[model samples]
Target: MAATAEKVKRGRKFAQVLEGARQVFLRDGYEGANVDEIAREAGVSKATLYNYFPDKRLLFLEVAKAECQRQADEAVEFDDGSAPPDRVLFAAGRRIADFVVSDFGQGVFRICVAESDRFPEIGQEFYRSGPGLVRRRLADYLREAVARGDLEIDDIDLAADQFAELCKADIQTRRVFRLPGCRSGETLDRIVRGAVEMFMARYGVKKGQTKA
Candidate 1:
């Protein structure tokens, strides 16, 4: 299993096939992803794609893992740990909101949900790379904030999870329920601010504290 997984990640055509699989799985999902469509998307022949991945499930899992890692790396790179809790939380919330409403995020989320029962590894990989990683990073910052007296929390993990939900819950439902079109950036900002305010109200060290 490990050997095949490594082979799937390496090779000249692996990058091409991975990107193609990412798109097709996001759009058509696990059960719906077609080999031919993925090949066409990659601008490669079916024979070439098969050289990297013989199993469709393996291909999809690799794609999900790659994409989630890509997003997580970007998040970590831009993250400012020295910032105040409110500022940090707001930034986290904004990033969550942006992804929740994005086409890629929504599609990947659906794939994880739809295939969780059948392909547990795919869902698990997605969580580890995406939400799990994000939550851990948030928890680390929350712990730091608590030490610095910026915030108070008994369970950093729970609070981190709660803050994450708070970021997208208010507005993500519309998208989850298949609401038409994209959400406006202004609307996303409003909800992110509201989430940060609510979180700070519960844990903030200062009263009437504004974002720093």
Candidate 2:
């Protein structure tokens, strides 16, 4: 168990280094970023960074994983048990929207798009973190709703991803591009409300009733 515990600690440290590398790379770009800088940012030694990651490319991938975990942790929620499905989804949507609209979110997304041609691995990792996490959590929620009889989903996972796409598509893209006049309190509210209505229209069913 000591070996296992040590491995876990090392893995966590590596993950932190990756996260630091990602932030620095996103802010400074690939050529400008350095492993030593990443180590300093992550509070690890240069030797430690190399102990976990042999190259900058691997560190970048790790960074993507860390970011994904953060977003996944933030966007997914436990059922309050009292609120309706739409309410729960809306709450989750709001959390996602808030993140997408932030400066750091935009920076990271920009890095993914800009660097995709040069670093396909990083691009894929970014996709896995952003869209991948969203889909997984949404699917899990939909499956739960199905079990609870709030929804009648034959394909819970796909339904969850689609639901998240519907909720986030506009805000996410616009925010990614830093579009002008693309958002306001009213806009976010409308987006959430519209997404909830659309989702319920498709998957929601009267309790205990099978799909028509």
What does candidate 2's lDDT look like per residue over 75-190, in tens digits?
A: 56647467788888888776666666777677777777777787676667656666677667777777777777788889877787677677676888777667875467777778
Clashing pairs in 2: none
Tens-digit lDDT string for candidate 1 (14-59) = 8988898888888998899899999999999999888888878778
**Each model's lDDT:** 0.80, 0.72
**Over 4 Å off, model 1:** 1-3, 6-10, 76-82, 180-182, 207-212
Please name the candidate that would achieve the greatest TM-score relative to the true structure. Answer: 1
Candidate 2 ranges with C-alpha deviation above 4 Å: 1-24, 31-62, 206-212
In candidate 1 the C-alpha lDDT for residue 22 amounts to 85
TM per prediction: 0.87, 0.68
